[model samples]
Target: MPLLESLVKRRKNREPLSYITGKAEFFKRQFSVDERVLIPRPESEQLVAQTINYVRKLGIEHPRIADIGTGSGAIAISIALEMPSAEVFATDISSEALKVAQMNAHKLGAEVEFTQGNLMGTLQGKFDLIVSNPPYIQSQVIKSLEPEVLREPRIALDGGPNGTEVISPLLEEIRKKLKPSYSAAYVEIDPPIADIALKTAQAKFSYAEVSILTDLAGLIRCISIENN
Candidate 1:
């Protein structure tokens, strides 16, 4: 009852529920969370699950994977936990977020190599799967977001005027670095922007197919791009 009361109070005051509870569940596991990192959303779990399924379908064992803009290491760590043979690299631009992610990874006994960098800039080599839940909310829209979302780091939420600042750059970089060796890529985005994302992916890669996956709310919450 005391916990519930605290959560209610926090929510009423615009605090993120995860911040009040200090934990969030993703991929059937609880992860530590705070204002320092964006709370892991259920939609992201779908992205992880889809990515895992796609990789397994390709019969690729011990694949190398990279999770760009890894906030709490949810995406990367979840993959590592499911596919022990996968070499997972989790990168973020904020050191504070990385610290939280590192601690979460350690606490969960997930072997994820965490790094601090803007998107895939510091990453090297090719990956069988590259995934990201980058900031997709436009700057102006962020101000109008629910109080809970406003509590997260602005760097992790604001995606410039069009909500594609980080995403555009990340996609461009991925296109440049992606090789025939890599099999698939997955990304999470706002449902309203799914068309723009699909168009961008199509324009960037020839053998890419963008499939929108709906969340429990029936919104197009995740975009999976399979590249040849």
Candidate 2:
């Protein structure tokens, strides 16, 4: 009751619900969360699940994968836990966020290589699969977002004027990092930006096909691009 009451107070004060609860669910697993990181969203789990399925379809053993902007390591750790043979690289811009990701990885007993860098700056070698739920919210909309999201790291939410700020650079980096014969790349984005995201992906990867995936709420919340 005490904890519940405290959480209620914090919610009343506009603290993110995930921060008050100290945990968020993703891919059927709960992970520790706080103001330092973005709360794991359900839509992201779809990306992870789809990516895992894609990996399995490729019939590739011990596939290498990268999860960029891995806030709580939910995407990377979830994939690692499900696919034991996968080598997962989780990267984040903030050292503080990486700490939370490390803790989650430890709790889940998932072996993930954590790196500190913006996007793929510190990454080397190509990955069989690359996935991200990068910051896609436009800067102007950040201030107007629900209180629950306001507490998250701004860097993890602000996607610049058109919400494709980080995405533009990320797509370019992905083009360079992923091998010519990769399986798929999954990205989560606001439903409204789905078309633009797909266009961006298609511009870079000729074989890319973007599909709009709906969340539990029936909202198109994820964009899966398969590069054959």
Candidate 3:
């Protein structure tokens, strides 16, 4: 068919299929995606699962959650839909990405407040749970990445020279934003930065529990900070 031929041509040209189709699935739900937003990945589902489990484990009746760099609003929207009583807020620096996220939230009927700002800087008050999938890929590595990946927004993938550019500051900021107790934060990271993440979190939360969580493929993918 003409559509199939066009899709094949796009694939051959290294254009991400998700962008070509304008859709990407996340947390078992289909989300509208375009070049403006990075496509959601399965690894991020672990971030969402861990966040939800943390809330249920603590038995928080009304938890305040924040999702930074919420590209497609997948994590925030999914959490809001799962825990209807919880207050969920998502932030992104890109207005275009936020537009896609807001559209998805409206389409899914997920009650998530989307804000435009830098990371968690826009959020006020302490949160019971905070989660983010900040850009963790090293700047140099990004240039050598697959062509399909290079097509994604650079701001959503580049983590500066050392790859901890966003994460380091985020950990520092999270300590101030999270509740003193019974609060936690989950952040996705590249495998190479696992040690750096652990070190940063340990330094930030001396008394809190810090651990690295692995994805289904057994790759270190998330840094978990529990302010117990």
RMSD for each of the candidates: 2.2, 1.8, 1.0
Which residue pairs in candidate 3 collide?
A: none
lDDT per residue, candidate 1, 93-205, as tens digits? Answer: 99999999999999999999988888888888888888899988878888788877778898888878877877777888877665564477888887667788877877777
- The lDDT, on a scale of 0 to 1, for candidate 2 is 0.86
The order of the candidates by lDDT, greatest first, is 3, 2, 1
Clashes of 3: 0
Stretches off by above 4 angstroms in model 2 are 1-5, 216-218
lDDT of 2 by residue, 4-114 (tens): 888788879988777877899998899999888999877678878887788878788989899999999999999999999999999999999999999999998999999
Task: Estimate TM-scores for all models.
Answer: 0.92, 0.93, 0.97
* Alpha-carbon deviation at 16 in model 2, angstroms: 2.3
lDDT tens digits, residues 1-228, model 3?
Answer: 999999999999999999998988888899999999999998899988998899999899999999999998999999999899999999999999999999999999999999999988899999999999999999989878999998999999999888999999989889999999999999999998789779988998998999998887889989999987
TM-score of 1: 0.92
